[model samples]
Target chain A: MPMLDLISSTGVAPNDVEPALFDAAVNQDIDALHLPNDADLSDYLDALPRVKSIFVDFPAFTDGRGFSLARLLRHRHGYEGLLVADGQLIPDQFAFALQCGFDAVRVKRSERERHTAEAWQAALDAFDVTYQRGYAVKAGPATSIFDARLTAAEANKTTDPFSA
Target chain B: MYRYDEFDAEFVNARVAQFRDQVERRLDGRLSEAEFRPLRLMNGLYLQLHAYMLRVAVPYGTLRSEQLRMLAHLADKYDKGYGHVTTRQNMQFNWPVLGDVPDMLADLASVEMHAIQTSGNCIRNVTCDPYAGAAADEIEDPRPLAELLRQWSMLHPEFSFLPRKFKIAVTGAPTHDRAMVRAHDIGIEVVRGPSGEVGYHIIVGGGLGRTPIIGETLRAFCPKDELLPYLDATMRVYNRFGRRDNKYKARIKILVRETGIEEFRFLVDEEFKALDASDIMVSQAERDRIAAYFAPPEYASDIKALDLEAQPEAFRKWVETNVHTHVQPGYAIVNISLKDPERAPGDITAEQMRAVADLADKHSFGEIRTTHQQNMVLAHVRQDELRAVWDGLVAAQLEDANINLIGDIICCPGMDFCALATARSIPVAQKIAERFNDHARQQAIGEMQIKISGCINACGHHHVGHIGILGLEKAGVEFYQVTLGGDATQTARVGDRTGKGLSEAELIDGIERIVDRYMDVREGNERFLDTYQRLGAETFKEALYADA
Candidate 1:
């Protein structure tokens, strides 16, 4: 086991890893590019269509720049290919990373054995509810409790509006 | 008295289960301490100097009698039989074993309460005017909107890991701003447009920390329905652009300051327009549904009036000092002071909690409210039952009768409890309270907010105090810096720091010197802050160091 692990919602392992350097990737026509945590996504927005995978680095798990970058890549640039979250990610934050539009996570080699595929699966299902919108969940984007309550309240309306 | 729905109940329980698992793993060596710290913090568990402190959220300061009883229960069962009320209208139990936290959370969940988002670098417990629904000057109750935000910001995916903790405060009354909205990250004042459409006047970037700054108005009149969308956009902008490199400059205020409010507003507006507003917005009907939960409890209009003549002098003083006017006639709001002598300010014992719960049930329609100044309020008490309520409070040692007075001080859990504190605040506050113990003198001093913070974090909100005392460590020795003329009202301003820091021994003497000068310079019953405003901080600064 190389411990070069990539976990996705579909449980499929990633293929043909590419170098992380931007100029090298551009010169070599690499399909995948792992950008540092501080990388500006707009600079590479045009190349997103051509690229198959974009792994945003999380230098520190607490530093959430990767969340913004992932969202920008997906929502702003419309990068539909696999978006990977790389480095220093805790298993608990997997859902947040995924919700921010990352399709996969490249677990560090040392911790790969402990963070198994089943563990990642369990981590995703840790919480059944989210209040945020624009998240990419397995069952498609989930509507918040407020929206659900509104729908229920609208359907159950039976009398004069202000009588109660 | 907004009861939790099935959704809220389930959400909290699920969070408890998740935290329980996280805690178990941490204990079993499966999860590292680093990984577990954030999880524990998000659940409102902090590793304090002595033991684990668990902070419980009292959403918008609204608590039912049952909830209060449950808090009392937790205090007796797990803690040291008392809980300290925080400035943000939450309660903190000083000692809880890490293993028992999950159980405590489960207990909290049973009461439709959990510590989720209470201590994390996320949207914390939304605070509002404690007298929100009952205030005579209130345009509308702000608690409903505050609750809506509480739901929206709970476990928000992107905002859960913010650069710094964010706070949001709402107020319905413009004249009597008890929430201190200007001192929060997001200050929402309920407003009505010229065409008679109700909405919010949003203020962004205002906060109190090492660098205290008042929030600037982002939108003068944001349509009521557009609030959620606008807030979503604003938070998104802050999460993406807020500085993370420096911990001290991580608040949205710094970003707003550095990038300029106008540019920050533009960025937020651009994001607001670009994001699909429909995806984030709740319908007016949904808003109405939430509002209906906070509707006024059934009232009995006919009630006996207070016998002003028959009351004792102490009772009369208590009525004048501790009671507030309510929107509904014959109803009065009674403030239960936690700043008693020889006790830590804002600490209520388990017995006192149960007593207050009993008082709520008997006099205030089984409801209680927590004020930002760390006092409890019986917001719907009948005026005729004032004497009875006073008697009950007196029996429980809760009738301090010094709210908004000199003795009723706001003191943070300083070096005594808080790990971040450089000097002790409780003793300084106690000494000040002792110095101004005379009822007549305190009444004469009039409405003055004396806030004390342990460190530059400003948890005691010393920036906006009428008289602020900041405790800082000077070469391993405790020292206090004084400030004057800070106001937390519509005309919000940070206090000006006086010259020189005083030693712990000189703190009380220095304050006395300042107060004596205030007494000497005062004319026509001017408050301390008013006198300071007229005479300026320079006079106080000179008087303070005159004897040094």
Candidate 2:
């Protein structure tokens, strides 16, 4: 009954005694907020400034509501904290989990028996090019193939005046 | 037709390697059936009743001659020598072994095709009007936009594990909705704004499985660059809020129905406003680059003559049924009838496929298009070479001469193949076609669509047929239900159910009786659906159960 977070390429354990401080969280005594997979984020949008970390649950891996939850927390609410994916997710979903803005993941001990952190990292490195825009790239600023094409087009325009 | 650039080519090749690795893991003990099921389905491999079925995406229903020949090669080598064209503008090989799928995929990748997302709970293969570029009524070809969406949704992270499968359809023509955009999850229509700005009219939450619902307009007009972001917002809303408690009620249509379209629109708008699309929007250069691949094929402009006077009556009938007007002069879009009475609708043999591929290279511009009605189209055939194409089709036994006629039925791979089917569909379609196979009699019936689904899942799109048939199992015996007056045109509607279910023999008789009823009380040149609408379903209901 442990959470498997694949967000960190080099896995991270759950912060012990962290999620149980809801009362303290209400009083601005804590910086983390743990939410169920279906937690309504509208009520917490006002509290995002106080909260530094959001741990979204994936009750089951088949329930993908958490992916959108993480996306909304990051892109919409502008939450730049440790967005942790905590649940039963496989290594195959590592790339997607990262693209959705999860900085760390907690995997179940059972799943870790066969799939190690290295396997998850390998899975993350499988795709060389993705058509999405929001992932934290291995190197420079986050950009899709379209952005790269735009940059190249601009470079060509500068070099070859007649290209336009 | 859109040609694959280096990016697309490399993307598909990488996917082939990935699928090969996944298959190897499955064959070993690394992945369980429960774990491997979704992965296999994402790659369009389904374990059906008989064997593994692989559905290959025909992106926007456009295929080059080499791609068709590759499909034929795969069918002959790895399948049972035939392929079935699906309603989603895909080709399904129903007999591929699990081990051979990766090799088959590699072969498809060589021809710039893949089975990715074709049968998964994700954004599926984007379908468009089969007559997109050639149709005279089109404002602009929707294939560029469709291609853009295809790339955007491929392996999309947050939206990949949707509650149910998502389908998007696009159409450029205002009047001729061959893509059935109104009945899709997200139907897009290309439109020109007041000042001549090209944009998209977006519709959301329409689907036709067990519950058939027409999509409501979400955005009247969104700028071209805003298409992907708008879609990202809508998908985020659906993924976050769609019901997962029940599998049947999990489609976006159900969500839109349960939570009103107004609320859904508000949620999407809020998300759209929040998401920063500064770097995500499709750049003009990228759009132009993609559009360039779809430039008009070189066509003979001076050839305006067609010698139909010397042709036989059968060939003339074929021209009348299968030929459609093109936007360009001296060119016609030819509809190849896959609904030959001798074979199942949409099922093409390997030899027939090769023949069609050769015909495509010779008559058309080495391109073929698959329609939602489970037929193939040569979208750029010249009028002068129409006779040669007709002759080639005749040699392959594909000259059915019944494009929109009674014999042209759309049927699903029912209990015979599909694991989800409750009763058989192909036999019933074959029987009905046999009863109404007369060429002259079929012409007399006029333009009618008889769509049959083995179960209420409605893969055959029976919900929108002029004469819809749904097969069910009652007391361990097969029974059929008849529905009337459905249309998938600009005016989309779900068919109304008639009397109780009938047996196989009685079902055929019932349809004949219904046709007889239409013949007796008919107006000139009125379609079967129009006739049924003029005289209500109640009249047909009475006529059907008069002797019951």
Candidate 3:
């Protein structure tokens, strides 16, 4: 398979693939156009009109900015595009990807495939659904002034005179 | 003690679960260490030089007896059977595995506790006085405001990530216990205005790093009600204008320095007007509710101190060394020194946690505090119970009786854990404390505080120590520099560096030389600081290097 490596922000995939290439065959892009490990959510928020599955870079796991980008693209912007993590993308991110809305992962051919696949499946198997707002996180009753005012508004039929 | 409501309970439980899931993925190799790192970090986990360290927040340095016991449980179960109290009033476990952390966090959550936001670039734990409610000199208890900030910043959408870490300290008393008005990213100190109304004196940009700055005064007087919004303004100005180009220069302290305090204040004031000040942010009812939670519990007005017909000389020494006056007339603030003579400074075992909790519940109110100097405090014990409390504490091997003395040293975990540290600090602190263990000799030496930092980040509160010792690596050899007559008291000042750094062998000898000089020159048994003030640094500096 010929890889379209993206080397920089201004660069694009080496091969001229049609938008149809996403489902037809697996194509890889390199560091061109400076896509992140987590695909650019803001860019993805715009129409991908041409590319479908693009490989993003993780750089490293500690670089959570990429992970966060993936989350925004999948959960908030609601991008259904196929996302494959490239570069320093570790299998650990695969589960977080699944949570963030990634389907498959890309790794070196020399990588342990079976274990990686098992871990990815385990991550998916772990959680059931998207949280309205992360059901798993502990909720604080009194969070914001707005939250308090809203709660107050709900409690008293009398209108809150001091609404923020 | 403020018990966690359902909301508090739920928040911590879910947070624990999230971190647990993240940890499992890391161990299973599903998540790369890079991807797994921030998740752990946001949850207060850090992979340092030796192993993973989890810094659990003892909010505003306040913890209930049961909450503290849980910390002890984690110490026994997952760590090296001990935890180190940090300068920020948090506890850091040196050895924790990536796998057992979720369970550790779960244990923490069961007691309405957490390790959340203890680190990372987000709002770190809010710090207040170790003696919050009962301190004699306080204008008001600072815990409620600390809690307010905790809620306002928790998982805050915009500030979950910022240019750099933010630190804020608060104090209610006339005497600064929290170092509140220092050069914090933001510092809050209570002051009485001409109207005799107690209002916050806001300070900004005071911090220690590559650039050490004392916070510049932003507001001489701000009403208590406007605090959150006022803080919102300060943060907004920082968020909009703070330097994002350099992480080191990103603290508010740098911004204030460059813009100048007057200009910075002008910018913050402008932002304050634009912030969400509508009833949504802080309403009367909301304030009342929060205030209700923090309302002082009524005490038995006539409660008398017990008759201590016998006061052990040891108890007297401990009292002389450790205890302080509380705001509550009959109560005393007991400082429990964690710096043992032979052991590492700030290392407290799980059993010790239970012991401290027992002391809190039995002798004092059910509250304990962790100080910025990495010591513990039993905040409101009746003076009458001092002997009994001392006896119980002594048995736990906790009554080091070295508070504020030369032996009560503040030392950081240097090369042992902090990858940033250039030299070992614990050994140096331990060595100094051991030298000063002779009570009479220590009295002769006089009131002195020794603070040590492995590196220059000043996490050990070294800058403000009366005898500040900064450990630096000189040609791969650990070298120590001593600073004379600094203080972290109500009126805090950074110490002046005396001269050249000393070698490890010569470090203790250097301290001894300085002390011996003070003893010789002293007109009385006043502190080293008083004598230094009376005689000046030239005499002490000359004495330190006289043998050299």
Candidate 4:
């Protein structure tokens, strides 16, 4: 597995701290926790204080439950610690994973070989603009098309005071 | 009718470039078919039974004359010779080489149109009442809202890959559900608040595939500005909790069904509460900007009402069947039927497309609308010019005068083109149309919807048809099952299945018998659905199975 930090746009060496499964993490003093897509965050609320890293399993790239889980952890339950997307994911999903609050993606060795690291980096700049706001990327909060339009409108207003 | 501004233009061009690159990658073996399928589908390309099918999104079913001309060009250049207007109010070119799709999309981009989100698990093209601005009883034009949602939902990173494809429909008229709102994943009805401020009544989880369910009311009144946040919240809930174990149980409807509407509402509200409304709230300025494009076109003040009394018998009948009342004085909405009994329903030739574009420019303020019933509408046609428009349509052979008659059918491209179809559907629809081909008989049967689907996917919306036909393969033989009393209006209901499947030979006769039985048992002035509602499905079942 190779870890790519989308926020930094750089590849990082895989960490030696293996994520403990839900059952083991519940019983043991594990700093890194691994949860399935269907893992209820409420059940893990007690363990959140001790866990420094959380790995959400995607199972398959098409199954998007992990994206929501990551968002729920960051925005809803306010889990600010490291969140890693683990399992089958393609380069096209790197930017979306980042937007959904995943700090890094741990890609399978096979997928990494198929889709080079350059491909993953290029995918980040695939679309310069997005239509959504509030979602975070490595840069900062996503700037929506509406936000850009509003800015342009404001700049025009300031430049031409007489124009309504 | 909303024209793309610089931002929209840039976004679509960028998307086209991305898709082109993806296609090149797939062709050169950098991307495998397993990985390329979802990507291509997101761009509205599908590998059908024949060649690739490219569905171009006609956002809110509104198109300009120039856009229609572009579609005509695409049909002539890329397809065999025609395009099919689907039940979702999108246009599908059934024959396009995989290599040529990128170029086809680039052509569409020139006309401010793209096929993005027309397919795939992402939110599909938002459909709306074709008669939005013209309908007499409309509360407000739903196109602005639809356009806003379209922009917000496109390329939405978080909700792009969901458990299954999501569909949304909007209806402005309180009296009619012309968009088939209640049969979609999220149905929106424009409503006036207590003080007459426009808002939306949101319905969640209504769909018509394997399991037919009318959406339950999720929100009584979602303020106009809060729509995106609310929808974002709903999508988040569905994406997170919707089942992924089985593809069949993956739609939001199943999630809503399993988790009770009450709990689902709680979850969505929780997600909505976490969202920052200002991040995505549609501003008043942006709202007005979109709405300005949809403002009613100027009309002739001195236009006189149409006097059909002295018109030819055929023209008068066409007006009686195809004309709909418009809000503007001396204006009418003209429905151009694509159902000719000779051609597949919704299939229109490129020549006819150009003719429609020309006619639209001359008679309908250069605007055309595609309907859920696979028909085209000239939304703002002056009553005085309708005769000329009718004449033009007749010249083009696009004038079928079967707006809601038995001849008007909504059918999917079944086994002839769709790879997913278990049996043929278009031939059955053609047979039914031919059997009742008489103008007087069709008019007498009156306001019947015969929707046919090749498989249980219900792309033809057979679940909501008045006389629904579902074609299936039983023991390697084609079998047709009929359902009765389905409605797609404000009071949406799934049709009840009648006993026994009929062979292709017996299907038309069974339908004819059902119609004959309805004629026998119906009260005066009642439509087929009204009669069915009064008499129940058992009566129709008896009629269908009597000879068997």
Structural similarity to truth (TM-score) of each candidate: 0.94, 0.95, 0.79, 0.95
Report the CAPRI category for model 1.
acceptable
> Per-residue lDDT of A1-164 in model 1, one digit per residue for the tens?
11226554353334433334454445334466767766756667656666777777787778777887777677766779878888888778888888878876777666756666666666777766666655636532244676667667777776778776
Model 4 misplaced regions, further than 4 Å:
A1-31, A46-50, A136-142, A159-164
TM-score, predicted candidate 2 vs. hidden true structure: 0.95
lDDT of 2: 0.86
lDDT of 3 by residue, B345-430 (tens): 88898888999999999977688999887799988887878888988988899888777778878888888779899999988887
Clash count of each predicted structure: 1, 8, 42, 0
Tens-digit lDDT string for candidate 1 (B343-440): 98899999999999999999999999999999999999999999999999999999998999988899999999999999999999999999999999
Q: Write candidate 3's Cα lDDT for A36-64 as tens digits.
A: 44232443334443445555565543333
Off-target runs (Cα >4 Å) in candidate 2 are A1-24, A139-143, A154-164
Summarize candidate 4's per-residue lDDT along B1-548 as a digit string, tens digits. Answer: 79888888888998898899888878888788988999999999999886899999999999999999999999999988899999999999998999999999999999999999999999999999999999999999999999998998988878888999999999998688899888999999999998988899999999999999999999999898888889989998999889888989999999999999999999999889987676567789988988999998998877877788978999998999999999998899999999999999999999999999999999999999999999999999989889999999999998788998999999999999999999999999999889999999988888999999999999999999999999999788999999998999999999999978999878888899999999999999999899888878888898898889
Order the numbered candidates by DockQ, best leading: 4, 2, 1, 3
> Which scores greater on lDDT, model 1 or model 4?
4
Q: Superposing all C-alpha atoms, what RMSD in Å does each candidate have to the true structure?
A: 3.5, 3.0, 8.0, 2.9
All models: lDDT? 0.85, 0.86, 0.71, 0.88
Q: Higher lDDT: candidate 2 or 4?
A: 4
True contacts kept of each: 0.47, 0.60, 0.03, 0.57
Candidate 1: Cα lDDT at B234 = 88
